[model samples]
Target: MNDPIRGTARGSAPAPLSVLDTALAGRGVSAADALSGSIALAELAERRGFTRYWVTEHHSMPGVSSSSPAVLLARLTAHTTRLRLGAGGVMLPNHPPLIVAEQYGLLQALAPDRIDLGLGRAPGTNQATAAALRRGRSDDDFPQQVVELLRFLDDDFPEEHPYRERVYAVPGPGQDKENGLPQTTGRPSVWLLGSSGYSAQLAARLGLPFAFAAHFSPDHVAGALRLYRDRFTPSAVLTEPYALASFAVMAADDEHEALRQTRSYAHSMMRMLHGKSYLVPTADEAASYPYTASEQLVLDRWTNTVLHGTPDRVTVHLDRLHEAARPDEIMIASVGHTPQALLRSTELIADAYTLPSTPVPVSAR
Candidate 1:
């Protein structure tokens, strides 16, 4: 069998659950300094041997300040000696092609092999925020935007390319590795992110890596994964069905502490969804809050999708999920009030859920 996704990656496997710390700024840190510290988290992930460090983009988000992934990633590259630093997703619908191309291109220049450019078609915000980002695009323009972005980043466009003059990923492609480090081959690896069958179909058809947003969109995980694998075709980006499944995780020495942390997250989510004081409360503060039936309902919905509890407890569910999805990599998303707590979670997962020492037999292997 011709292996699928061969030479695609060193850490792209399903067993080890990779950790993704999005909304790092939401840990109640000052926006200005939070990004720097978030980069520190990325460094820690590398030290802990995580697969990657991805920051998300969101405009006008109170709890998070990662509104510009390119900018933050640049800062991160300067601080982190290792770790593949990239966007958990740069929402394609929110921006135009050249802007993203040039920005991430610059990032690749700074840290070549250590980059990935995952794109999500979702606005990642409400309609109000979407309108604020760009007022002209229609619903159909979303996929076009993604196609345009890939064309720009891959540097495959010709001089006659319609957007070439207006677009450039400057100081192009000189990034290289000195030691056993990761380097972008000028253009970063691209992945399609989604929570629905639509994205699944798109990823499969394009033969690109697929990452399901099961961290928050658990309701559709199994279905979406099925669609992605079933409809998969071989393309330049990928030769067969390769996936990176994600789920929220919280680990601690004790199960009670894990649940306590989840309660805080649930409470904060309620504040975000409803009109309430919005803050990413500490576990202590969350444990103190009085959750209502409304909040409980919200918690239940997320719990179905989120992987919570101690490593032992969480692994059982994650293992079941891995068997079902058979992802190339599994990313665990987490955030906490203190950076120490966040780092601890990263270390815990790395120690407990990493892939087997010997590589599994990949389709392309």
Candidate 2:
């Protein structure tokens, strides 16, 4: 099947690539250093022809420092000139819709058309942190929250709506009083992020671009994308289904080095699975740690989900993934013990695909 968004048939070639950063902070790496690494990664991604650099939201994880995507994206705006900066994504259930609108509106003001607002319903954290962040708010109202958020972003609440004329999101869509024609200060591109069929249906109904969380929920990727495309309805924002799949990828100079990095990342995942703090261990630490029978089973399962090997090996797997899912774009979430490892993976993947060294203009994207 042909994908209108990319103007290509499935499996013909890889689609546009992007980055999904977690700002890993562990193995003696400070939070500040992790953030700096993210900035450097963003700069390199832009130069390597990646279209977007998106930061994911996670809280109470000792190894992750990208808890506030909007704040981190604000910093990213100052570092890169052409790359699209976005939250991949902000957990909308954790904040008021108006607040989300205002925050992203501010980003648009800073970077204009380069800002993207991807929203998710998940808390992006454990139960206790979710409770603290939500303050007893119900997550069942996610659909309605999206509606209200869109109104604020477009600044187009109907006349009968209570928020119309009573409240406003500054730096958002508005009308010119003199001519009465509507005007907007560059509204950011809005995308719906999901890991299940529910979010896929919602994104379809809302006519927004959809991004599947394939990095973690690999089992649900195909079903979610199928539901998204099958039910998609056209809207002003999107005329056709646009779907992106995010994968956890790690590439290295050799298969052995990649496996070493994978083990380090898997050790962190195992700790989180066992309810321990998600502080990533160094490769040597992972190699030396004694693993019980059950832990080895768990590590083997998690390791299978991560695409890791030499650049050629990883690229082959990515191609197979593209052939099966046919996503309009692929977003990479690289994992490693150090910033240099992640950077090297990114450089290798870009070179393997022969990605341009020049920036892809906003219009072209």
Q: Could you tell me every candidate's TM-score relative to the true structure?
A: 0.83, 0.93
For candidate 1, write residues 92-166 as lDDT tens digits.
877777777778777877886777888887776666777888786644776777787787676556678775555
Tens digit per residue, CA lDDT, model 2, 144-248: 999999998887899998988767776676533223656646677889998889889999999999999999898788888989999999998789999999999
Output the worst ten-in-a-row residue range by lDDT, candidate 1: 1-10
Clashing residue pairs found in predicted model 1: 3-363, 3-364, 4-363, 4-364, 13-328, 18-332, 112-183, 112-184, 113-183, 113-184
Task: Predict model 2's lDDT versus the native.
Answer: 0.85
Segments of candidate 2 deviating more than 4 angstroms: 1-13, 175-184, 359-365
State each candidate's clash count: 10, 0
Worst 10 residues of 2 by lDDT: 1-10
